[model samples]
Target: MLNNQKIKKMHKLALYESGEGKKHLAISNYYRSDYIGLALIKNFFLTTIAYGLLLLIYFGYRSEYLMENIHKMNLALMALQIIGLYIIMVVGYSILTYIYCSVKYAKAQKGIQEYYKGLTQMKKAYDREERRNGRITGRRTKA
Candidate 1:
């Protein structure tokens, strides 16, 4: 699977080298991704906001339902336990996001590098062809 991905990337670069289109890979890889960091920050903000909104909605409904646990959270056990659970959840989410982003960024860089490598190969091929053709004054080398 990984080999297939690499070959696909190489083919894409070769296409670019052949002047198929502007290199999207090079453009994307030019910038520092900070992909995982940004994702973690965004996730933290979103998760906290979502949890806060849920708390608000629960309390608002509780006022109507007239429940005993009006403002309390369902921590279940001790404060330490709740904190531990929160830590674990956040850490797990962070790890998953980091892995995803890292893979994407690395792949992007890989693709662009392959593209440049392909271009180098293409340049060499053209040079050799030109040398062999001897279209102008130079004598063609016998194949």
Candidate 2:
């Protein structure tokens, strides 16, 4: 005895599992705050590395000027300016990462909720089939 409704639901579930379900499951495993925090940490490190590379390129381009002005330049002020720029870059990127991760986590949780609802429906269908076949008792108790 094959149920068309059950078969359709099963097909849908299979498609989801093969596609976005993997990402949704992985995202749902983490707490919202934890996910956002992890993203922020990664963002910080990436920003730091990018900034370092930019500094190296800038110094390379100005090598001749820097060498000529080495004795005349205000080294302390220049260092302060570079530190300030790095701080700004890191803070800006962290804020964006936090917002993006928060939204992503929320969406994933919503998807998992829907998936669970589908599973519940499938379970009920199986119970109904069992009752029709006289394989079980009067009522099906949920666990």
Candidate 3:
């Protein structure tokens, strides 16, 4: 015979493995997507900063070379071009990341809703079985 603790544990496990479990899993996935989006954004920011610093260093070296060789290099125009390129790259990457993460989060939430609906159906079926049988049983009795 199943003990009270065992029965309770089984019921809990059953509920956890049902639609409720899916909902919990989907919530976790949603959080994970947020974290991933944050990481992506952070990485993009760091990379852009690094690229800007490198560009500045390169421009410094190039300015000295241009001063020694070409007497009329347009330093201001070159700097503006580099800054504009960096801004464009960062904006494009941010937009792409936002779209990808939004899609991922939406899909996760949809999965959670589907699981919740499945659990509701399962409960309804269990209730109907119990009502028909008068009590839940592990085995059927032959008439």
Ranking by TM-score: 2, 1, 3
What is the number of residue pairs that collide in model 3? 0
- Candidate with top TM-score is 2
Give the per-residue lDDT of model 1 (tens digit) for 1-143. Answer: 13464466667765775562344454363454555667779977776776567657866877665365535755456457745756766778778877877777676667667666777775776687667568565786655
RMSD of each: 8.2, 2.8, 8.4
**Quick one: how many clashes does candidate 2 have?**
0
Ten residues in sequence with the least summed lDDT for candidate 2: 134-143
Q: For model 3, how does the per-residue alpha-carbon lDDT over 26-129 read when each residue is reduced to its tens digit?
A: 45554766656785778698769877798879869787786786657677887798879888788777777777766766666666666567667656665665
- Give the Cα error of residue 98 in candidate 3, in Å: 2.0
Query: Global lDDT of each model?
Result: 0.64, 0.89, 0.68
Steric clash pairs (candidate 2)? none
Report the alpha-carbon TM-score of model 2 versus the true structure.
0.89
lDDT of 2 by residue, 56-137 (tens): 9999999999999999999999999999999999989988888888888988988899888999999989877777666455
**Candidate 2 local accuracy as lDDT?**
0.89
* Residue 116 accuracy (lDDT) in model 3: 64
